[model samples]
Target: MIRGIRGATTVTNNDAAEIVNATEELLWEMIRANDVKASDVVSVLISVTDDLTAAFPAQALRRIEGWTYVPVMCMREIPVPGSLPRCIRVMMTAETPKAQEEVVHIYLRNAVQLRPDLSLTRKSEL
Candidate 1:
């Protein structure tokens, strides 16, 4: 079966270190939430809000996780006026036997404030 987890996070600034750390935290949460191993991740797509371009969040994850073998790509998120700022979003497609509803999604930081509907586990994980 194929399952996917989508995560989004808002950053306070455009610093590279901050970007890397925030993305690392988000990706870590996503991995742990679904019991997703490195091998389970089929591919990961990342996008940053227009204001953020210090470093690709995908590259940050690659460096932090030492994921020399994971397929990752990064792009710029569409900019709409008044949209979330300094945000890095991830959509991960994984190969798993679990149903779609069983997959875990992550929203972090001020991003959590964006989706109060998610469960406590999801809220606290990131």
Candidate 2:
């Protein structure tokens, strides 16, 4: 069965290094929470708030040892009024046996405010 794992994180600034580091951290957390393997990932879709323009978050996936062939795309999130800033969101599709509810959605850094209910397992508390 195919499953979609959701995750989001925020960077302190629009620096390329910050974006890449935060994205990598979030992706790793998502993978660990869902027990997902790079080979099992069908694709990864990432969206960053308009305020972030230093780098494409997809670059983070390429840094993963076994994710060279994993398809990933990145784009800008719609600039909703009063919405979160410097945020990056991800939707990872993969083949997994776990049910939807069993999948853990990760929210890290300032992005935790984006989904308070799921913030129980925030990176800082993990």
**Candidate No. with top TM-score:** 2
Q: Which residue pairs does candidate 1 place in steric collision?
A: none
Error of 2 at 54 (Å): 0.7
The lDDT for every candidate, in the order shown, is 0.81, 0.91
Candidate 2 per-residue lDDT over residues 29-70, each given as its tens digit: 999988899989999999999999999989999998989999
| Model 2: residues with Cα > 4 Å off, grouped in runs | 121-126
How displaced is residue 120 in candidate 2, in Å? Answer: 2.2
RMSD of each: 2.1, 1.9
Q: Which stretches of candidate 1 lie over 4 Å from their true place?
A: 64-66, 119-121, 124-126
Tens-digit lDDT string for candidate 1 (1-126): 778788888789898889988998899888878878777778899999888878777766676555668899999988989877888889988887779867778888877665667746664545
